[model samples]
Target: ATAEKFRSISPAEFFYRNKEIAGFANPARALYQAVRELVENALDATDAHGILPNIEVSIERDSVKQYVYRISVKDNGIGIPEKYIPEAFGKVLFSSKYVLRQTRGLFGLGAKMVILYGQMTVGEPAEIISAAINSRRIYSYRIMIDVRENKPIIVSKGVWPNNTGWHGTMVKVAIEGDWSRAKQKILDYIKRTAIVTPYANIVFKTPDGEIYTYLRVTETIPPPPRETKPHPHGVDLELIKTMISETKAQRLIDFISEEFQGVGNVIAERFLTKYGFDPSKDPKTLSKEELELLVKALKEFNEFRKPRADHLSPIGAELIKIGLNSILKPEFVDAVTRKPVVYEGHSIIVEVGIAYGGSIQPSEEVVLLRYANKIPLLYDEKSDVAWKVVSENIDWSYYGIVFPAPLAILVHICGTKIPYKGVGKESIAEVPVIEKEIEEGVRQVARSLKLYLARKQKEEEMMRKAVT
Candidate 1:
């Protein structure tokens, strides 16, 4: 390999050449991750509009192709608009998720990567059916990616009037997959997603003629996360430059106050005076060096209020308990939602739930179910910070928890930015603040379980005394 071999490739082409980074490594994992990405997109669509989600997913072997499976997911949520549908599904890194919000998908490349995989493996175009909310027309397209150009090649397009007044999105793709290797994980992902989102009705059909349904237990869903400006902390110089270039505000003082969260005009004025910058100077006039210095000052000023964490929505504690009860059917269940905490200027909330006894079959250790932004983490358990907290920071004996008992613990972290270890988004890195919050939340719910167990023990002893 030499410098002469280097050539610039489009993002789509790069990911197509190296699909494993997007979780499309092998036949087994590819099938599993395809379902995960599609379902995550489905939920995000519904959650954005507070729509009661009704989703249907199915995977089956394609009739003529060996080891090729057809994957289809349909959701009754707000549909993709007509104009952006091509790029949204066909191009790489083109998505609505590149904003400040609590969403299941952080990287915008996942779904399109799945589409790219399908195109390369099976030589098939993606089938899309969508009816956006704004118009009374529905759209259908058979499209594929021109990876070298990062553009969508529309094989065919169809549009018709919406007679049923339905609005949602459905995407179908056929790809080479091994359904047997990851069957259990596929099922577990769906079930855990249902547990976390009690308001979503999920019906999943496996390739082996099995059907599982998770109906909506509650009609309520969490309010959509507000789209606020970025916090001043942990911001880089490039983003500041972009904000300055795009901002409509004329004065530097107004730019600073308007662009960042919690930095009012008064603070901006004081910050400008302290930093020896002209407050009335045009924001767009700042040089790269000056912008760098401004960012440093913002981080060190220490007078900015905490990021507005209330704008982020967490799966409430009541819904947590209800979802766990409905799924685990345990004898005792409790959940705790901790107050919001900031990590690298991103607001995060950790919610923990514990289910003990009854139908929960335990093993040598606690069964840890981890989630981030409501998407279940099915792989990489031990490396996750949630696992680290449960195994090391928490003392199970102190909470009356014993081995070989019916027990399960749930840890969910909702935030504007999830500290994922990789593009897989399967595990969280151990930030001190996040780990502490998880440990504290777990202990709170563990205390409730311990009290319940202690009372149960006392009742058993009293019954024995009466018998004597």
Candidate 2:
């Protein structure tokens, strides 16, 4: 059997073999995911820099091969530095989003996967043009991924004269896709994205010469989330050790106070006393057994205050109203922004909105629009935690909602660490605390819907009496 050829593959090689896990299972899904990943990256870049986003996406079929399509995304955001552009687009698992903040792209694999899919299917390098914000110089690169080695293979790199004074990034890739089959899904994703991120301006040119634009309703960008220290309950043994190694605090007590939230001089000293450890001992000098004991103490300690919410940037109730109003056009609309809650020591906030009557048509089932960190979750609605909470936990009939009722439910979860079910990030994982918050948020809005329906019923009764 050829001497049992077996060797460990690089991250790129593994993903190349199992592209389905990264949301490129088929041509149709691949096409949709590519657009989503790129658009999300664009949004993140702009949001991080506090700039209003202008994004343009275009898809065109190959002249010779109808199945092959050229996909291009342009964004007016903070562009990648010239040197980092190749690796940023070409290397797998390379990312700058490794901080504790609410961002759309968490794993750092989305855009790279798009490049890999394009290269695997059409054997074409990605074309990139970028200019840093406030810079007049522009840089362009033609780069492809070396899947076996997980590195960027640059085909060409050069500078271009900037005439329009634009500062942002533009990415182009050629890949095999069935746009005809993926058209509706692609459009729906973009529209839902616009609904969630009303501050963004998006324009799409489809393969069939269709132009769709979602204009920005407001220039006000939501406040960017601030990075925060890890919470005591959120850290594990491995993370504890890593923090101990990297922290600059000389004493164990100081390290705890400086590295973790909810830890101060008093709390840190108390923890040391309870654990029978020297508060003055150098944290780096702790032995393996001592570190293990510290981890245990952290897990068992209940006196620690819940994680803070400064790291979370939830979509405000007013913005949710504006977004729903622009799209759903419902007769009655109500929104709730839940207070921040802690789960596994990480602070999370959930926002819920309800729109009833008017343009919203009643359906056989509830329409739940789920979002995580302001990015719309388009697929796997049936398996999401929010879906389960709405369908299984909430009794809609008590809230004056019935089958085919003209209603829509919206839920958004923002956190330092969202519990996503898998790499695809399509559904939120069912955590008890998260479920409780979601339930409470929905109920808050459901109560408003109930009142509206009750008023409508009373009005109808009065009309009947008047006619008699």
Q: In TM-score terms, which candidate is top?
A: 1
Q: In model 1, what are the clashing residue pairs, if there are any?
A: none
What is the clash count for each candidate, in the order shown?
A: 0, 0
TM-score of 1: 0.98
Error (Å) of candidate 1 at residue 159 is: 1.3
lDDT tens digits by residue: candidate 1, 231-266? 888588888888988999999999989989989888
Q: Model 2: how far is 220 from its true place, Å?
A: 2.4
> How high is the CA lDDT of each candidate model?
0.91, 0.89
Cα RMSD (Å) per model? 1.3, 1.6
Cα lDDT tens digits, model 2, 1-468, are 568878999999989999998889999999999998999899988975688899999999998999899999999999988778988988898887878878889887988999999998999899999998766789999999998899999999989777788899999998889998899889988887887778889999999999999898987778888889999998888999888888899988899889999988998888889889999999898888988888889988887878999767787888888788888888988899999998788899999998888898889888888999988888899999999988999999999777978878899999978898888889998999889999999999999888888999999999999999
TM-scores vs. true structure, each candidate: 0.98, 0.96
For candidate 1, the C-alpha RMSD (Å) to the true structure equals: 1.3
